[model samples]
Target chain A: MSSTLQSRWWSWGFRSAVMLYFILLIVFPILGIYGYSLSAGLAAFTENITEPLAWKAVLLTVKLAFVSTMINVLIGTMAGWVLIRYRFPGRGLLNSLVDLPFALPTAVAGLMILLLLGPQSVVGQWAEQLGFSILFHQPAIVIAMVFVTFPFVIRAVQPLLEEMDGSEEEAAYTMGATKAKTFVRVILPAMLPGIASGAMLAFSRALAEFGAVVLVAGNIPGKTLIASVYIFGEIESDNITGATAVSVVLLTFSLLILWLVNYLQSRRKGV
Target chain B: MHVEVRGLTKKFGEFPAVNDVHFSIAKGQLIGLLGPSGGGKTSILRMLAGLETPDSGDIVFHGTRVNDLPPQEREIGFVFQNYALFKHMTVQGNIAFGLEVKKWPKNRIKERVAELIELTGLSGFEKRYPHQLSGGQRQRVAFARALAPEPQLLLLDEPFAAIDAKIRQELRAWLREMIDRLGITSIFVTHDQDEAIEVADEIMIINKGNLEQKGSPWDIYKNPETPFVAGFIGESTIVEDVSTLRGFEQAADWPGTKALIRPEYVEIGQANEFRLLSATETGRVRHLHFRGSEWLVEVDVGASRLVTYRSLEKEVLHPGEEIQVLVHRAYLFNDNDSWIMENRLKEDPMPVHI
Candidate 1:
């Protein structure tokens, strides 16, 4: 009994210490960004934000995130559905392949894409001849972002689909409902919360992606370069104030979307 | 309505689950599918509901072959053992699902939902989710949902298995009244003999993927067609090698090959002269349990033993008492009586399981 009590105290102290360590290492840096952006004066924040080129980069970043995140959610939901509901040849291998981005380093993923579509690769020459440039363009950055976030939505919704009781559908079928109607009316409502959470995570991950965006954006001003890459350029040119302002803008947008997503999930549970 | 199952067989890989079983349920009748666990009662219900198709054979519902139809295409209502209520929907939503699936008029759906909620005694709880209710209440909601579609044949899989024993008893009577009031043809599967006896209009006893008997509760208790049905559905005592008595086969006049007697039919007084081993009841009373009015006693009669409930007027028999027991009417069965029910009076009732 005394040993059990001792172990309980040990676990409590160990968790508190580990939590404090993470708060200091991770939370402290994010706090520094927020403090520097807000406290360095509104004049600096407005002056840095008033730049048209930086504003254009922000717009491009939003568009890329929207386009890529939408495609990822749609395709990933279908992939999750098929993996959980069906048994096909090579299913295990396909499931493992979905996790390739999680294991592949961001720089290495960018390098691999550059090798495949760097104007000298097989598909790149054909695309060039067709007057459709895929490399060193905004579209190329979206493609790389998609490749990195593909597994997020699939991994999130797969367990939800598998854990579904399946009796409701059977019960619906016995009620003389067509299979299509049962899916639309009975199955989809139950899956919506899971899908939304997955989509939000994918969107946040896509917005924060910089390595792949950097390799493909080519740092073109007012054309192909994204906000993260533009921030990188401002730092390289000794403009820390402008870089901090841009970082804060991007951070606030992602945080607002995440907060909305969490609100929806908790409300769904209440229902 | 008048469902006929001919040569129904289902197999899962190398396991032969439901063999070539044959049975029929007349219209407006409630039939019991009674069996031990894994005796293929649920499998038969699934086949009848069109959720599962037999490997070979035909299931004729109202004289139409429905062997290949999916459950959605078949007009059936299934009450699951666990109720299987939608966790996301309220009681009203669950009942309205079937009407909505049929694309009924909006006002008609509302009227029907209100009627069913009232019928199932869930009017005030229509907005409550399934998890917020008791087991009995959840079962009532499932029943309401299933009957909302007004199915021709209602199928239930152990509807009372999830409720507490007391609540289950009350719900059994309510279920029978509700089903009879609607005049719906129904089939329910249960491993409980008392539940089957209490609720089913006719009982179908199944053992090891085979139909053992199909009869009323009284008939099943009075004369079981098979030994497994007899031993399983109720209590029985086996007095082996009783052919030693002179003219015992003719004088004793048992219908089948062996002599079997129910505990209630056995008397505890004088022994007959043609008795083997002095018609003895030399048993050591192992234990006595107080069961309200009567006492249930466990007696070790020789090498074999059985339980008997006897009345106590303050002259109760204690442990290690020597007494006399006699059988007035005995049943007879070998082992294969289920495979051939037409010959329930035959000399050999079943092939020995051993």
Candidate 2:
């Protein structure tokens, strides 16, 4: 083969390899799940999804994910800002620990939370006296989801904050702006894209959380049973169609969130 | 408003970034804090702007002591070296930020912003964000924003440091004109001596956290008080141990004296009334280069190389040729303890390693 033709052949080969990997690993599995879920016809798919228990499980999961993502956006943004802006003795250690959730197994995180906040713990006993049960309830599911998704917002926002020039904040202060106003008008807008990306990751992670949630939430059907737990219960009962149907809905929600995150990131970069 | 910085000192850990630096600016005067990088010029500017707190000092603005005041309460406008225009804000929004933060009425803000936009020649860029603007354009936006709230004092940290050379000259002239028209007490820090000379009515030269000289550009250039100012502010060849040069006065009383001779003050191929041709100093030409308008000729005087510029009208001199040069005036300073010699002599002269 001529040199140009040989190089072109290699380029096409690499391109095809990448496409094949995506097809086999991602596209094929997603398409199979959707096809299998709809194999029993649209009516059966709709009926399986409309099961009151399944609907409640999806709602609970979404509510919990939304709440936890909101919390993450606040606490994670503050954590990221503090880590990037302030100099403390253990800052380096704290910065590395932000990625602990990503490195640790979800089951281990669940057990750690269970041991720290379960009924036997001091904080858990104090909470129990206040007529609130953290374990085996909606809060437990949220706590587990938060633990597994803890790094999302912090990781997403930390680098941007680190790269951010503090001159703008200094400029604001020179313009007679209070610290609160500077953060709101100047700092927050600059961080919005990072915060949006982080919130999306937290939301998606919360939506799909299984190992941590299953251990801490106790999988009480219709009350604490999240969408992932509900799908697992369906599969255990030999209801593959129902499980796949609920998976499709959860996947769609996650896809929408991913699209939003991409949109925000692109817009920020374009601006 | 006039601003006074008295006995200002700041230390970063063991490093004294600005030590006992004191200077004051009159109302509506434009002063330039001129120095090389890490010379404490920026630190002094920051302290005056209330951005950095001094270790021990009193920053008084118009008789009011603002030492402990926060930057927001200082009523100062600061333009950062990087421009620091808000990336997410439009030109108008950036300019109007100060006014908006002060809670000015919407119509008043619009009016003020439009006026500033026109004044800064940014009429067409009102809707554009900082990233979309060029370096010069962003600089104008930063200036307009700082001026929006009508600050009592304006501080700029290397305003044109980031601009291209050609644009920097233009911006420097334009900024000086604008500041004069606004008549606000302003001080800008710059490492470029040329920029400081061209733009500032008064230039304050600092070196290694010490204030070397503070005067008008002409005065500072012509009459630098110390050897540091003479060498830093303009092109000067500092000859320590002035007794080394031939045809120099013998001063046994002051053994370690340094003489500063500016390149322009060294007359080549001519004898002035002070020194006749044979009586004047003679040095061999080491190298010569055309400096666009003049030729920069370096002549070796045995102990030191003397740098002087030859006008285009002068005859071209080659290497190894003896040239007669006359020094119109020389500034002398007591080189009591040269830092380099002291460091070489003492094993641990610097108590603080930093």
Candidate 3:
């Protein structure tokens, strides 16, 4: 009986220690930001968020994140399907390379994109000849966001494809479904949950991207300056309330998106 | 449709899953491809359904060569072992998928799906997903979905293998009756001999990627063409030498000394109860197993251990008791040949002094 009581006390101590650490590391900082955003009163918080530059930056962040999420969904779905269904030379190498973007520093990724699409590069010269510019514009911001979040959708989709039964495709074929129809009707629906959850994660990551966007977006007001860069600019200028308010907005949006992804995943498992 | 396969062969890497196997099925006949696991039964069914390509063969359906036809155009319905019902679709939606693919009218598809739901005894499960149903219900849904488009042939790869034993028996009978009513050429693969004997109109025994024999259940049971078929179809014991047994000494002259003796071919009785006492040999009882309606008695006759059944109505015999044993018939076989050999005493039952 004494030994049981000792183990119980040990478990209680361990639980409280981890809980205290989580609160001190994550919960306290987020609550502090929210509290600081409201420290100057509700009117000040509202005025700071509604400032034309701040609002425009948030809108531009959402728009570019949505665009990058769409691009990732298309490319990632194809890459996942090919990787799971086909056999080829260098397949193992290619599969391992998919996680490279996740492993590399986002700032390094931004520098690479800047170098590849800079005005002096071959791609930049070709784009200039076509009467358009890529670097230091919204397109370059989207490219950086795409690079940083490239692995999310593919990683999400690969497991779903692997878990899928091969006989399901054969059943559809025997039922008079063409290859295209089988993919659209049977395979796509099975992969939908993964795609949706991955896209949401990618969108949230893109929204908060600062290291990569700051290098190539030029940080122009009302054009390419995203919400994260704007918050950094406010912090540099000593406007703590403005930066905290914008951070609160991004935090709230990320929380909602994460909740949505969890809900979708739970529903898929339940079915 | 009348189905015929000529020289069908399938290879996986260097291993031959199916090697030069051939068979034909009459229209409306239910054929069971019975074999041990990894014996290419499923490969044959998949080839017929056009799910797997034969390395070199002709799959002729109704006198037309379909070697190049895709599964969608082959007009064959396949039921996988796990059913493979669309998990995301409701029962009604699953049953209507093939019809929709065939471009059936919307109302017609609805009507056919309703009819099949009722036919498969899933009257109120039309809106239920595959995960929400029992294994038997899932199998019925798969059957209904495969039959929705009215294909010419049906191929099932171990249709009842995934269900519980009780439900498996029920589904076997239900499948046989359903196939008979539909009058569609159907072939199902199974490793169970009893299931094949009970459900299939004809049984094709496959072994080592070869078609060993194909016949009706009664014929296959009565006359197994190959040694494998004889050993596989019924319970029997293989003895290395038959010359030591009474009245089976004539079988020693056959090319192979090995012989298969079934329980029914041996007769056991008391010393005074046997009418053919002159032709009988005294043996000691080794063991007895209770087999529901009878006692399976194992006897030690010289060096050979023989098994025979005693009716429950007869007096119980204890182990180590001496009993008169009479040999009637045995299947003598070698690696490539087999034939039944009857006891010489039964042919000429005159009192013979040994």
Candidate 4:
């Protein structure tokens, strides 16, 4: 009986320690930000959010993140399909290279994009000849976002494709469905949940991207400046309330998107 | 439709999954491709369905070569071993998929889907997805979906393999009856000999990428053409020397000394019960096993251990008891050939009541 009581006390101690660590590390900071943002009163928070420059920054961030998510969905879906379905030389090397973005620092990725698309580079010269610059603009911001979030959709989709039964495709073919129809009807639906969840994650990550976007976005207040950069600018100018308010907005949006991803995944499993 | 395969072969890398095999199926006949696992039964069925390409062969459907035809144009319906029901689609939607692909009218597709739902006894499961159904119900849905477009031939690769044993037996009968009613040329792959015997109108035994024999169940069981067939079809024990046993000494002149003796060919009785005591040999009972409906008695007859079934109505025999044993017939075989040999005592003047 004494041994059982001792084990019970030990279990309680471990549980409380984990709970205290989580609250201190994660929950406390987020709540502090939310409380600090509202400490200046709801009117001040609203005024700061509705400021024309701040509103434009948030809008631009959402728009660019959506664009980057779309691009990732297309390229990542194709890459995942090819990697899973085909056999070729250097395939193992290529598969391992997909996770390079996640391993590399975001600042380094930004520098690489800047170098590759800078005015001095061949691609930049070609683009200039076609009448526009790619670096220090919306295109550069998008490129940086794409590079940083390149692995999300592909990593999400590869397992779904791998777990798919080959005989399902063969069954479709034998039932008079053409190859294109089978792919559209059978394969696409199987890949959709993965693509959707991955896209949401990429979008949320792109919205919060500061290291890569700051280097290439030019920080123009009403133009290419995203919400994260605007928050950083507010912090630099000692407007703590403004920075916290903007951070709250992004945090809330990301939380909603994450909840949506969880809901979609659970629904898929339930089905 | 009549189906004929000539010199069909399929290779995976350097391994031949199906090597130079040929067979023909009559219209409306249900053929079972019976074999051990990894014996190329499924490969043959897949080639017939146009799911796999034969390295060098002709797959003639109604006298027309269809080697170049894609699966979509081959007019064959295939049921995978796992049923492969579309998990995302409802039962009605799954059944309507092939019809929609064939460009059937929307109203006609709906009508056909409803008809199949009723036929497969899935009357109220039309809106239920594959995951919501039981294994037997999932199999019925797969069958309904494959038959929706009414193809000329049906190919099933281990159709009942995924179900429970009791349901497997029931589905076997159901599938055989369904194929007979549809009158479509059907071939199913299986490793179960009893299932093949009970359900298939004709059974083709495949082994190691070769078609060993093809015949009706009774003919295949009684007259196995190859040694593999003889050993595979029944519970036969292979003995190295048949001349050492009583009445089978005439096998000494046979080409091969190896012989297969089934439990039914060996008779065990008491001393007074034997009519041909002169031809009988005394052996000690080694063991007895309860086989649900009968007792399986194992006897030690000289150098050979023979197993025979005893009726439940007979008196129980104990182990270590000496009993009179009689050999009626055995299948003598070698690597290249096999033949049936009856006991010489059956031709003797002594009357045997066995």
Best by DockQ: 4
DockQ-sorted candidate list, best first: 4, 3, 2, 1
**Tens digits of per-residue lDDT for model 3, A93-202:** 99999999889988999899899999999999999999989988999999999999988999999999998879999999999999999999999999999999999999
Query: DockQ of candidates 1 onward, in order?
Result: 0.63, 0.70, 0.80, 0.86
Candidate 1 error regions (>4 Å)? A1-19, B237-261, B269-293, B335-354
Worst 10-residue lDDT window for candidate 3 chain B reads B344-353
Q: Candidates ranked by lDDT, best first? A: 3, 4, 2, 1
Q: Interface RMSD of the predictions, in order shown?
A: 1.3, 0.7, 0.7, 0.7
- Could you say which candidate leads in TM-score? 4
lDDT of 2 by residue, A100-214 (tens): 8989888898898889889999979998999998988888888888888888999888878876688889999989899999999989988888998999989998999998888
For residues B1-354, write the lDDT of model 4, one tens digit per residue.
999999999998998999899889999999999999999999888888888899998999999999999999998888888998887899998999999999999999999999989888899999999999999999999999999999999888899999999999999989888899889999999999999999999999999999999999999999999989988997999888999898889889875669999999998988887777877899999999999999999999999999999998877899999999998999998766678998887666655698
Give, for candidate 2 chain B, the lowest lDDT window spanning 10 residues: B338-347
RMSD of 2: 7.6
How many backbone clashes does every candidate have? 4, 0, 0, 0
lDDT of 2 by residue, B55-164 (tens): 99889999999988999888889999888888889998899999999999999999999999999999888999888999999999999999999899989999998999
lDDT by residue for model 3 over B125-156, one digit each (tens)?
99988999999999999999999999999999
Q: Rank the candidates by TM-score, best first.
A: 4, 3, 2, 1
Q: Which portions of model 4 show Cα errors greater than 4 Å?
A: A1-11, B350-354
User: Clashing residue pairs, candidate 3?
Assistant: none
TM-score of 3: 0.95
Off by over 4 Å in 2: A1-5, B240-247, B250-254, B270-278, B302-304, B336-354
Q: How displaced is residue B239 in candidate 2, in Å?
A: 2.9
